[model samples]
Target: MPYVEVLAPQVPNQRKAALAKSVTDGLMTAFGVTADTVTLYFLPISPDDYAHAGEFEPQGAGQRILLKVHAFRRTEAERRAAAIALTRGVCSAYGVPGDDVAVYFLDRDRSEVAHDSKLASD
Candidate 1:
């Protein structure tokens, strides 16, 4: 199963829901996995939850978006690309202009995450 988690400052109820649904659909299509088997998580974090560290982010606190996705079955590179693309899609869907967004992906073998615990490979 593919696990996805997204974090961003609070947005309109309808917009947030639509963004989540759009992401879920994109992942299902990109990973060639069943829609039911994917576990998508969304977390909205305020300015306190973020810290800007680069030249572009050289300013006080502001709204930001973080997206992390973990999946079994694909290589790390593949997963990362998919995650980045999804983040871009989300940015466009939400009409986020000049916003900060980041996406990351973690890959592991299917056996790593079992029903209740991490397996030996983990």
Candidate 2:
């Protein structure tokens, strides 16, 4: 299972839908994973609660989105492709600059994950 977490400011439901589709498609294309196996969670952060460089509201500070991708171990090339796809999707749907987004890949072992009351390794 590949789980993706998107942390950024809140947006309209339509934008969320588009982001979900884009990320899912990107994962499928880059990771060879089925749509059903991909999972995404959106976490909205309030603007007031965010600060950068000790500034409450930094001027020209575009939206900073953090994407945490968790999945079974994969090659560096795969991670790079996925990162590019994800960044493109986020920039397109969220209307944010590419420099404003950050992506982190978390590699896991099948035995480290559990689903439906069973370990993924089983």
Top TM-score prediction, candidate number: 2
TM-score per candidate, chains pooled: 0.73, 0.91
* C-alpha lDDT (0 to 100) for residue 84 of candidate 1: 60
Model 1, stretches more than 4 Å misplaced? 54-62, 97-99, 116-122
lDDT of 2 at 104: 96
The candidate that wins on lDDT is: 2
What lDDT is obtained when candidate 2 is compared to the true structure? 0.88
lDDT (Cα, tens digit) per residue for candidate 1, span 69-114 = 7777675555655766687677876566435666666766766777
Steric clash count of candidate 1:
0
Q: Which residue pairs collide in model 1, if any? A: none
lDDT of prediction 1: 0.68
